[model samples]
Target chain A: MKETWKELPIGCIIEEGGTSRKFKTGDWRSERAIFSKEKCTNCLLCYIYCPDDSIIMKNDKVVGIDYDFCKGCGICAKICKAKAIEMKPER
Target chain B: MPMKALTGNEAMAEAMRQINPDVVAAYPITPATEVVQLFANFVADGRVDTEFVAVESEHSALSACIGAAAAGGRVMTSTSSQGLALMHEMLYIAAALRLPIVICGINRSLSAPINIHCDHSDTMGSRESGWMHIFAEESQEAYDSIFQAIKIAERAYLPMIVSTDGFIISHCMQRIDMLEDKEVQDFIGECKPHHSLLLTDKPYTVGPLSLQDYYFEHKRQEIEAMMQVAPIIDEVGKEFGDKFGRHYGLFEEYKLDDADNIIMAAGSAAGTAKVAVDEARDKGIKAGLLRIRVMRPFPYKQIQKVLKDKMIISVLDRSDSMSTMGGPLFIETRAALYDTETHPPICDYIYGLGGREIDVENILSVFEKGEIYKKKGVEKKLAFIGVRE
Candidate 1:
């Protein structure tokens, strides 16, 4: 037996991207693949080729995603020749 | 604390009894039938309030559990090789629907050449079916993991698959410390459905066929949920360890502190690897064992961290990736450690496949051969342990 930390369920996490509401309701089912900038080739294949249109543009480079809308099909990783894209499980 | 001398199957039933699930659905199959049989006895004796549903097939077993879980009921099931294969369809559905049902899979060889013995192929075959897979090295884990599964599954709302080596852990008698029923009941608590059928008064569909418009989104959500489960499992395992004094994590490390060689394995093979590691250590060889407890979430960070300093890592897989370059687990483990800066050279050995016995001798021999193979680098074929062909 060890110390019991305050266990928070997936649904209870605070949401992001809100000016009015700080702690937004989290979606346990939504996941997005975060790309490692150091490893990325900037091929834009993940950008021009996204099936769900979840991949977005940022600073003239392919970046950012709406995981709530993005289905983790792993298409970007499959197409990334550099293997820069890694699917991170999101809550 | 009343101690019980029980087999793995009996302990599993005791865990179920402690959890006091709403439904217990399973089909009779070799090495696994005893699990459900003991559960049925628990139900008969009125020791636990559960619905013991004897289904006609493994498919029905999982299907019924799926329905029970979706309908806001805590459900559990158990089966083996062919039976797991039989429930393949429902396994996908259970995860897709985000039902928190947990099933016990007695790891056995998939039938083709036809032998009813222990192997990972049975459970390995379902590694990607969107279920959280946890393998037990012995009866303690077999009993304890099931209790943790309900909490883990429900928290993430993802189906959980808990497995152990067939006959080895299932039939072998072990002195297991049964968790107090009140403790288990309190730990598991009540099932809080994210999308319960009983809440039909609100009128929300549970599993609607998503067309091209929404099917992809449904799948994406499922993947996200699975990813969340990794940390949740870690957190819950820590809590359970606090409650029950057993810490079950992504993997258990043995003698890796100074070892240059590490062996990657799952299920009961981890125990065998420990024996070999001890032998090798006694012989002044820096060999260690990494027993994978959680497979689906594939503890990449842990593997990368533990194996980063090792000179060579030998991944022993009980199931072959089958025509792939290396074993399936090897592929996953390599991928998990891919981006890491301090990762070691990893190779794979496919042994104990098809229910073949992997004893202490087999493990030691594998370690010896693994060192030799490590010098040569990744091989085109996996070395077969205890196999003569």
Candidate 2:
């Protein structure tokens, strides 16, 4: 029920920017990242290193993990020096 | 119309001067060098208001042209042989982006031995580049096709390259009738890019990274656009003819009516075929020539209609596909006639590679073979002319 090839624009020009938000890459996660706020230093290293910007932030403080865009890359978990994030296999 | 003698490059340069596009970005190469050089002189003399960019390489020349075209400017350029080979990569980008950039190309042999005379190898090599190709027989046709090319490219939103045979047509002096500058300007009018980088207030990604998700869809759009070219070519050619007394079509049929034998060709080879047909007709033999003008959007339907009733036909190709079967034109022509109920036995005569001379004698021999093909049947489907062991 998606748009057919006939409905696409001429040339591969993406007319609207940020249309990438429509495709949720969370389905690509074989393993998911789990964040621990209690042991967190709140250094924002995970927030800075997360490729998908899935590290949730509320008023300059680390909140939780946003599963929608995260692909379980674990870059945020690896970059977290405070051991505030960990990757767990998905069911 | 004013009559004057000019070489193929001169004629094309004159057309470019009249079109006077917004930008002219080009690197000079043999045969096609005169075209851009003359245009540069036009620029120097202040004859036209165009941003002339003399790039270092043919690749850069086409790259600059693509950028200028994307920036909502009418762009033009010239190149031949290795220059065209170098621009091969950028050629597809221009057409895929739906940029209406017109290129004046002189057909020359590609290098290995580096023989630079005349052949269809340059344009034929780039056959799948997705650009509209209009092959002219002579200087007049080359000159006339240039104006039509600009209009066709802009109208169809596809880049178009009009070619003249190197040395044979490009250097040969011939009489051509010229349209007044005002008339040509009025005819083509202007170039209005469909989706331009500069003609927008909203931000739109021009050439985004298209992969598995939407690549096919985008390519399908380009294919659909090419499907729309045949009619536009007819309309533009007709309009040019109507206003200037010179008509155009997808392919020009010379003495095809009631002819038992037909010779299909393009470029300067077609020019020689005309004389061969005339000579054959004088001897009470029915010989005809079908000069293909448009190669891309290959006029299969139109060609099928004309070739349906012929007794036998031969496609004279200037470039060998090196596939061990036949030449490029030969393969395509045979494919086009696949479903015809009265299809004549089609054969191919691969000739004139590396600018070999295909004289009237060479063409007449092909016609002589057609008579035997009509009776006995075609044994040799492919033959090379003027090539030594």
Candidate 3:
């Protein structure tokens, strides 16, 4: 039955591009939110809700997101009043 | 237990609240702005804990939703007319990524002449974007299809569009019995992500352009996933009926079992046809109505089953195909029945363009004209309703 089910015409929509698969089960969360220096405020919302304390600041200005520990919840971007934080797929 | 008063826009918001989507990114547009506003109010009042992102433009609204869903969150967003046009690029990308996002597309006439009433032009233009399309007849179906869309899309890993006629359902208020919060949550909760971003350690890339060698395979896989959705939708619909006592199918038949003639339509026109069908039944005309809810994944099999022995099938599309031989939904319905051995004579009627009122008399006229073609045994011609040119 599964064989006939495979041959059944489910229409043409099912054939669209979806071959790109994620490498690791949790790799998407490891990437830390990065702030473009030309575009960030020292609001510290990222620091407060990194959920892992993955954000740190220095000299009264924004510093960096700790990729080693930052789970990319994107709450930082949601809470950013300046929209300074950007979540990028980690290398 | 049976009915509660709500507008189509309000029901859309209510459905979002019941599903408890993780995020809702929305911008306001005519006829559909109220849906977003209702959802925003639900978020503000703490009724739904979704992160309601009030974006600046429709593009950003849909982009933000794509970002959230790619991060493995159950996301929802909605727009209509120009807003839908603005998000055109993102709509295709969302479907390509298999984001499992659902959108409430309050259908409206597209611009240029700038009409704010009901039509399917906006939805029709996006028909090939790889999103499952579900049409709702009234506020209750609008409410129910929302829940069903999430389940189907998540399981199939495809996006869905739940559409309703703009002013017809969006502005009118009606009483609908809403599924209890606990019940709705249980039914839709099966869509819980297999490996969402909340859990750290897995890495995935979504929506990357591939070379010619790999492009076909990627598209093939998406089709496989979409094919899997047909059975899932059926199973979920049955399960929902068992739990909530409200039953819906891909094609909803009203008084069609013993009828030889049927008027087929979608969205609110199907509701309008129901009233007319009731009147026709009283006169012993054996007239009935077939309302299609789930338009994509086309429900070809279910349509074949319901329309087995009918003598004539009249399909009414609320939007024209412009210069095409038939209307958009009409083309699809005809295609579905074309290969079947037991299908009936089909007629295509294009009506209610740009929100012209479809009164009972108009419904009767369409049916009678279709019957005239049936009696003469000639192919039906494309029609225009209230079209004075």
Location of the lowest summed lDDT over 10 successive residues in candidate 2 chain B: B195-204
Q: Considering the two chains of model 2, state its CAPRI-style docking category.
A: medium
By lDDT, the better pick of 1 and 3 is 1
DockQ of each: 0.01, 0.49, 0.03
Give the winner by lDDT: 1 or 2: 2
Clashing pairs in 2: B241-B246
Residue lDDT tens for model 3, B74-131: 8999899889999999987887677888999999998878999998888888887888
**Mind giving the per-residue lDDT tens digits that candidate 1 earns over A1-91?**
2211122122221112222222122343355588787887788898877776667677777766656556777788789899888887765
DockQ, prediction 3: 0.03
Which consecutive 10 residues in model 3 chain B have the weakest lDDT in total? B194-203
What lDDT score goes with residue B298 in model 3?
Answer: 82
Question: Which candidate leads the pack in lDDT?
Answer: 2
Question: Which candidate, 2 or 3, has the higher DockQ?
Answer: 2
Instruction: Give model 3's docking category.
Output: incorrect
Alpha-carbon runs more than 4 Å astray in model 1: A1-91, B373-381
